[model samples]
Target: MRTLITIVAFLSFGLLSEIQAQEKHEILSPQEFCDKMKSDDVQIIDVRTPKEYKNGHIKNSTLINFFDDDFKEQLSKLPEDKKILVYCRSGNRSGKASEILENLGYKNIYDLKGGMLLWEKAKTDCY
Candidate 1:
């Protein structure tokens, strides 16, 4: 019974820690994200497949396929010091990628709220 209680407590702590880490990197709206891209010296990362990115993506975004097995290895080429702005076709993948970057201790991470689709839909005269 004591062992069971300890295991449960450990699991709860681990889960809570993961949740807190994710919360530290919150997703931002498309407009807010675009504003940063325009004014700040930010690294725009497109976390989509190469094929998808080739079709269409935000201007000046570096293509980094999140599904690739060597995704983190590829990410190593990017400067750790730059502010990273990330997005996907939709919100799902970029959100996960942002969390991964956060876990890797990368500061200044921003995720596009509804991703590229929303950005294009908003069509707010942004690239």
Candidate 2:
């Protein structure tokens, strides 16, 4: 029947969209990422080495070294209810870190697309 076919098609499209969304990490540009981080409740993280973090970092982000021996444990401490925003020097480590967080049950993660390099290039204010 025509109604049956329409129902099936609609269901299929909905399921496909859900799958695509579930597999995606929100990759944000420097300006976009900074704009999103303006939300006071968001969890901002700097997933870089301590030395790199010490040199300069986002104003409100927490420092959780992705290379630390207990990196997984450190990440586990964050509450899943909040949105997590992560960045590294050049986005490579942050990409991997985002995957790790997803595996650990984090439902929301926003990764900086080109990391601090792009952030600085954009001339966005940073502290």
Per-residue C-alpha lDDT of model 1 across residues 1-127, encoded as one tens digit per residue: 9999999999999999997866756588887887888856689999999898988999889999999998987776777878899999888999888878877778888899999788888866575
Candidate 2 local lDDT, residue 21:
78
* lDDT (Cα, tens digit) per residue for candidate 2, span 1-127: 9999999999999999998878646899988898888886689999999899999888888999988999999999998788899999999999999988988988779999999888878966543
lDDT of each: 0.85, 0.89
User: Which candidate wins on TM-score?
Assistant: 2
List candidate 1 segments past 4 Å from native. Answer: 1-22
The TM-score measured for candidate 1 stands at 0.78
Task: Supply the global lDDT for candidate 1.
Answer: 0.85
- TM-scores of the candidates are 0.78, 0.81
